[model samples]
Target: MDLVRIGDKVISRHKIDSFLTEILQLRSMGLSQTDVAARLGIDRTLVSRLENMGELRKGKSVAVIGFPIANRDEIYALMQAEGVDYVMLMSESERWDFVRQKSGIELFNAIMELIALAHSYDQVVVIGSGKRIKIIRAALDKEVVGLEIGESPIQEDKYVDPAELVAVIRAIKGGNV
Candidate 1:
């Protein structure tokens, strides 16, 4: 009985660590708090607490985004005590299948939703970004009024400066969005 209990505890810690890392990475990728919350069917406060464990957790109305966690019940209680959201367990195959068939526009909107939900100070930069992830670049082009940094093969003539890209995002927040 002792050995089995020890094994379970070890597995739980390993799962939680992986869950935390995945969540942070997804947030960096541009998913929003609200999206994450919606995905988990919980409030944004829970998400924030889950992300920031050591510091005093501050709740904001911003939409949050990140990975869907596994072992959610355990994470939830941990969040209550530690001030973070817990994991929502999904099998690896399930996660893969969801992304495999998701449309580009759907992916882009998903990313933007996450970005919008993030802290104002956080800048979610998609590096070497391309349209392959989804039809997001084109959709973003239409919906987003700011400067886009990446080069698009489809739009052979259109180009945007990297510095201007930051300015554009700032401007969008200022009123352009």
Candidate 2:
């Protein structure tokens, strides 16, 4: 345990941290603020204030997935800047390598896992060929925004305009897209 001496009193940082963790865990487990406060012997307003301090935004979660992208780095940076919940971007060579390195079952399991994760997001932005976008839209049940970089069977990496991607992200976060 670590102690901090302030003036003539000693404070237990560990105790404070444990209380914070417990409070958040209880809140996440569907406990109301009043219930959590009563259980923890804290003011209900403190719980509300703590939640507000940690809140990032007040909108739906978003995911961005793209492959065979020449500007993957640029797009990834934009996703990070916009605080996207999930991001998956790959170049043509990287995508080919990823498929070739995995066994048949492993590849299938990986694809299934990706689809399951995408299902958790409120919206998904798919950037690829028209055919690929159509396939993803068919697989996912949530709202999907398709930004077609090229026609079907895209064999080469296509450059995605960074400004266009930023606009899409802004619109989604603003709940207008």
Candidate 3:
């Protein structure tokens, strides 16, 4: 008698199953396979195979990547709604490394470029948190060209209200603020 044991499997098919379900859910909800790949940071071929397997659920727009971590679309959408056109997402370590390699001037220039991209918008919103937020706030205060840093010099006093930031950008560009 020959018996097949699931435990004999080399790879974790469950993970594959999970990935498939997630991809299918995203696809049915109107996300293309390429979009799924971009959000998941994986190849489109993997998503294609999973869709073919029929291991996916019918309709689920959002896939929870290991609980707290979600794909990029949610983050991007949230930023957009918040009126933030200049969104910089980097790790704390990366922020520190950037500051170390480039003088505040160079970093300031790069940030201005990001803000300038929002010319079509009425205002530019910069979304950040933690050390990243602090660094961005500081760069803005230095008159980063496109941004209107708050009147307060103190970091605590410097807050980024999406609406306020937009107002300031409009004023500056329109020569009102």
Candidate 4:
């Protein structure tokens, strides 16, 4: 057990951790704040404040897909940091290699699988040429956030602004857009 000393008062870190775990478990089990507080003999506001402090995003799963991106590594790191559930990013050459490596039937099956997986998420963010984004949006049934990096027939990798993508992600997570 870890101990913390504040002047003459001593606190057990283990006890505090266990208490917090119980509170969160109760909340996850669908207990109301008031009910949890009454059972734990704590204030209702404490439960509310604890939940607010730990909340990262609204309970929605998000997926991000981008291709022929110049800054794929930067965007991939950003997506991981932001807790994006699914990420598919590729450079121009990588995209071509991917297509060239697969047979026609294999490619079709793979695309169908990707679309099926994407349908499981609450929202999808597609970063590509305008036409590709439109096509993806039309295929998906759920919310689709499009970040058009270039016009149709984009042959070269285009750089996407990290700040712009972050804003879109935050808006979606905050239920603002």
On lDDT, the candidate that comes out on top is 4
**TM per prediction:** 0.25, 0.66, 0.24, 0.66
Record all residue pairs in model 2 with backbone atoms less than 3 Å apart, i.e. clashing.
Answer: none
| Runs with alpha carbons beyond 4 Å of true place in candidate 1 | 1-70, 80-91, 120-177
Q: How many steric overlaps are in each model, in order?
A: 20, 0, 0, 0
The lDDT per prediction is: 0.40, 0.88, 0.47, 0.89
Candidate 1 lDDT tens digits, 42-154: 67887788756533222321111112223333433433443223222223344465667679888778657644443232222222225421343353332222223244433
Per-model root-mean-square deviation over C-alphas: 20.6, 17.3, 19.0, 15.4
Q: Poorest 10 consecutive residues of model 2 by lDDT?
A: 51-60
lDDT of 4: 0.89
Per-residue lDDT for 44-80 in model 2, tens only? Answer: 9999998776553534788999988998998899899
Q: What's the lDDT for residue 23 in model 3?
A: 74
Model 3 poorest ten-residue lDDT run? 60-69
Query: lDDT tens digits, residues 40-117, model 4?
Result: 999999999987876544437999999889999999999999989999999999999989999999999999999999
